[model samples]
Target: MASLCLTCVSEGTSLEEQVRRIKDIEAIESDSFVPQAFKSSRDDTKSAVVQVKQESEKGPSQDISLPMSIVYDDSGTLAHPSLFVDKETAEELWLNRLISLRQERLMGSPVT
Candidate 1:
C-alpha cells in the first residue's frame, strides 16, 4: 500500500522551508516501493492536497470524475470522495467485452 502526505506552510515562511518540503516529498516517493504521489497543489485556502492512484495499465481516461468509496485494509471508512478512474470504467468494460468476444471466436473455431 502507498500513501502520501501533503503539508502546507505559511506564506511568511523562509524559502528554505518550502524547498525542504518539496525535497521531502520527492524523497518519500523515491524511497518508497511504489511511486504514487501526485504533484501537490494548493487552492485559495492554501491547503495542499496529495492524491495517490492505484497503478494500472489503463491511465486516466474518464470524462467525468466519479465519486469513490476507498476500502482500506484497516477497516477505515472514506466516503464520497471524487476520484479519477484511469482509463475509466468505460475502457474497462470495453476490454472485458473484447476478451469475451475473443473467447467466443475461439470457441466457434473447429478443433484441428
Candidate 2:
C-alpha cells in the first residue's frame, strides 16, 4: 500500500474555513489537528495536522518521509496561499493522480 502525506497550507479569513476546504476535497481520507502543534518562524502563523490518505491496489499508505503539518495564515499573508505538498514526497508516493484530478476540475470551469 502506498499513501501520500501532505501538508496543505492556505491563507483565508477563517482558519476553520481553510480546514473545511481541505476536508471538502474527495481525495482526503482523514484529517485532524493538534492544538498549537506548529508555530511559524516567519510570523505568528500556526500550523496543525491534517492526515490525507491515498488508496492504491496494495492498500492505504502515508508517506512519512516528510513533515505532515498544515499551515493556515491570514488572507493577506501571501499572494496565493493555497494547499501544497512536498514535490519529492508526492513523486515518491505517486500522488500525481490527485494533482491531475484537481487540474481537470479547474479546467472544466472558466478561469477568472
Instruction: Using TM-score, give the best candidate's number.
Output: 1
Candidate 2: tens digits of C-alpha lDDT, residues 40-111: 475634454455665678877754333355455556755553335567875755666766767877889543
Model 2: runs farther than 4 Å from truth? 1-42, 63-112
Worst 10 residues of 1 by lDDT: 40-49
Error of 1 at 73 (Å): 41
TM-score of each: 0.20, 0.17
The C-alpha stretches of model 1 lying farther than 4 A from their native spots are 1-87, 109-112
lDDT comparing candidate 2 with the true structure = 0.53
What is the clash count for each candidate, in the order shown? Answer: 1, 1
State in Å the error of residue 37, model 1.
64
Error of 2 at 42 (Å): 6.3
Residues 85-107, candidate 1: write the lDDT tens digits: 45678688879888888887888
